[model samples]
Target: MRPQTTLRRLAEMKAARDPIVMVTAYDYPTARIAERAEVDMVLVGDSGAQVVLGHDSTVSVTVDEMLVLAAAVRRGVRSAFVVCDVPFGSTEVSDEQAVATAVRFVKGAGADAVKLEGGGAQRLSRIRAIVAAGIPVVGHVGLTPQTAVALGGMRAQGRTTESADRFVREALAVQEAGASAIVIEAVPAEVVDVVLPQLHVPVIGIGAGPADGQVLVLHDLLGITEGKTAVFVKRFAAVGDAMLAGVTAYAAEVRSGAFPAAEHGYPASADAIAAAAAAAAAAAALEPGQIAD
Candidate 1:
């Protein structure tokens, strides 16, 4: 088995200019696939709310639901570091709430670290609080989905001067608040390039351009998510179409009575069958009012 990926190892990779690979996984099967593919990180992303649970948005997912996903991912991952996203309302109330939620991900689900969205003043405080509790935290900035409505409906960030400045400020503040790494999502690559040198922690980019690492939603990459996806998503495989084809073939076989053929079943001895037939004959012969011995 491969050795577990750690924060120190990730930092070393960043220093060596080796790009890290991270992917979202919601269940045991996906986690196993990620481990087999040799990904460096497996994130139980809140994106599972839409991709797996059929929720309209990440904000609708709760901590309990997130814990279930995280724990399953942890069970299947042996080497890749597992990070769980603390759902929307879990940490917004207070710094203490953030710590509590982070602890649950660490203790209850065996997460290597927890990821929190945003880098506002309150968000930085939450990051600091979680880090102070001895849990490693991954900070997220630029197009935070939990609050995307306020950011104008999931568009790319940092295209304008004001947004670019805020991106830089938030990115730096998150690093200063004790995040071991940061995920820069849905921001212009040019904007990310300018600020990359200013931050010390490894920056994992989604749509924000090449950083120390890159992460994509597993479903998006596997062509499992139907309809439109983010601009940055690159489909790597057609696993969804393959799955549908496989199931369709199975249904056809079943309808044709081709399934469960003789070869697919066990056989009983001739004597055994005869004995069962004689027992049935005896039972059928008994009178309606009488009890059979």
Candidate 2:
């Protein structure tokens, strides 16, 4: 078994200019695959709302649902760091509420760290409280999905001078608020370049260009998600097509009665068949007239 990845190791990797790799995973199989692939981190992201649970948006998922997904991922991960996303409402109530939610992920789901979206005042409070409670926190900024509506839809941030400045401010504030790492999503690469030097902690990017590391949705990268994906997603394997082809072939075989052939069936002894036939014949013969002795 591989040793667990620690916060110190992650920091060292960032210092050494080694790019970290992170992927989203919602369940055991995906988590196991991520571990086997030797990715640096596995995030049980709220994006699972769309990818796994078929929810329309991340906000629709609840803390209990996230806990279920996080725990399953935790069971399959051996070496990679496992970070669970605190869902939309999980941390919005108050710092105390945030600590409670983070505690559940650590105690119930075995999460190595918890990720909370946004870098507003409330968000920083949550990050600080969770960290004070002895649980590591990963801060998220730049086009937070939970409040995408307020951000004027699911679009890239930092396009304008004002927005770019705010983006940089939020990123730095999140790092100062006790986050061990930060994830920036859907922001311009140039803005991230400007903000990178100001940050001492590892910065993982999604649509936000190169940082200390990068993360992409597992389904998006593996070609399992149907239809359009974000610009940052690059399909590495057509797993969806392969799955469809496999099922289609199995269906065709079933229709043609090509499955369960002689080799697929269990062998039966001729003597046992004969004995069974004899018993059936005797039973039939005596049924109408008398009970068998």
Candidate 3:
């Protein structure tokens, strides 16, 4: 079996200029697929809210829901690092509350690390507290979806000079606050290039552009997501279409009675068949009034 990926290994990969691969997985099957692909990291992202739980946004998922998803992913992951996203309300209350939530992910879901969004004062405090509690953290910055409305709705961040500076500041702050790694999303590649040298930890980009590593949602990459996806998402496979075709074929066969052919039947002894025939004849010979509806 392959050995598990550790924070040290991640840092070494970054230092060696080896491109890391990260992907979001919600459950066992997705985790197993990710493991089989030999990806470097598996994130049980709050993106599950939209991709798996049918939630309209990431804000609707709870810590309990996240734990269930994380644990399921954990069961199937053998080598890649598993990081669980702390949902919106899970860490907003206080530093202690954030630590408690992080502990739950580690103890309840076997998460190697917990990811928290943003790098505001409160977010920094939470990251510090969680790290102080001996839990590894993966920080997220640039277009945090939990507060997308406050960010002027699901748009790219760091596009303006002021926003770009803030984005850089927060990215550094999270690292200083003891995050082992950071995920930058929906920011300009130039801005990311500027900050890359300043950051010592592994940087994983989604829509943010070239970094030490890249992460994409598993469902989006596999074409399991319906409707439009983010601009950065590149569908690598048409699994959704394949699923539809398989189910359609099954339905058609069932309708035409082409399924469950003679080969599908169980063998019966001659005596059993004879007994069934006798029973059918006796029932048919009953008077119309005697046969119950």
Candidate 4:
């Protein structure tokens, strides 16, 4: 089944019991290619600040930077829903300020929706304001990276009964406040499982698997990012290994002078050779005093 209208397709996928597969995409080529390859959603994630520009975390990504990538991804993607993050500190402003900033992602960046970190903490009124303004929102919860300093590293959330209940409450509130979807990240599968049955909107998982669908960091899945994937993250492709093999082969051929074989070498051209000899004579074998002798 084709997941076309981001929300429509997400709902359809949920009904079909097919897990949605969303991936982070920062630019046009990746977005268009992913949409053509038929992925459900293209997330212009602020992670670009890390993966592309070598930032420390999503926090360091500016709203301007996110919009730049979002627009690029928007131009590339068609059919699948394109969502952009509000980036850090953009939504913590007034309700009017939040909507105004989110509008930039849609109008300036061509995103279909905006995603904001944190569900229950500080400014849920802003989420409602944006949705009320007719912009779709994808709520993020359970280990929001925008709050990483407070969250304290990559730890599983909702481990305790109270925390679990809080996670559920936040998820439900976000959905009720009109989030088209929710991204459960870096949380236990149990947290995902508990929420899946409870929410009407589709649950797109990152570290959470087999929920309504799943999402991943594009670089990690493609093995372009150098590191081991988490236990929760599954590998559909070994892009890193494949890339290594490809580069290794190319390097060896180049070093051994085995590359640029007969076919790759320039075809012998009599005109080209004659032109080169004329250039060589002009450059070398000069009569030292010919100009004034």
Please tell me which predicted candidate would have the highest TM-score against the true structure: 1
Relative to the unseen true structure, what is the Cα RMSD of model 2?
2.7
Alpha carbon lDDT of each predicted model: 0.95, 0.93, 0.95, 0.82
Comparing 1 with 2 on lDDT, the higher-scoring candidate is: 1
| Candidate 1 TM-score versus the reference | 0.95
Superposition-based RMSD of candidate 3 using all C-alpha atoms, in angstroms: 3.1
- Candidate 3 lDDT (Cα, whole model)? 0.95
Question: 1-293, model 3: which lDDT tens digit per residue?
Answer: 88889999999999999999999999999999999999999999999999999999999999999999999999999999999999998889899898999999999999999999999999999999999999999999999999889889999999998889999999999999999999999999999999999999999999988899999999999999999999999999999999999999999999999997999889999999999998899889889879634
lDDT digits (tens) for residues 72-138 of candidate 2: 9999999999999999887888999989999999999999999998888888888999999999999
Q: Model 4: what TM-score?
A: 0.87
lDDT of 1 by residue, 64-149 (tens): 99999999999999999898999999999999998999999999999999999999999999999999999999999999999999
lDDT of 2 at 119: 84
Better of 2 and 4 by lDDT: 2
Q: How many residue pairs clash in each candidate?
A: 0, 0, 0, 1
Give the runs in model 2 whose Cα sits over 4 Å from its true position: 271-293
Listed in order, each prediction's TM-score against the native is: 0.95, 0.93, 0.93, 0.87
Question: Where is model 4 more than 4 Å wrong at Cα?
Answer: 1-3, 283-293
**Which parts of model 3 have CA positions greater than 4 angstroms off?**
271-293
Per-model C-alpha RMSD = 1.9, 2.7, 3.1, 3.3
Clashes of 3: 0
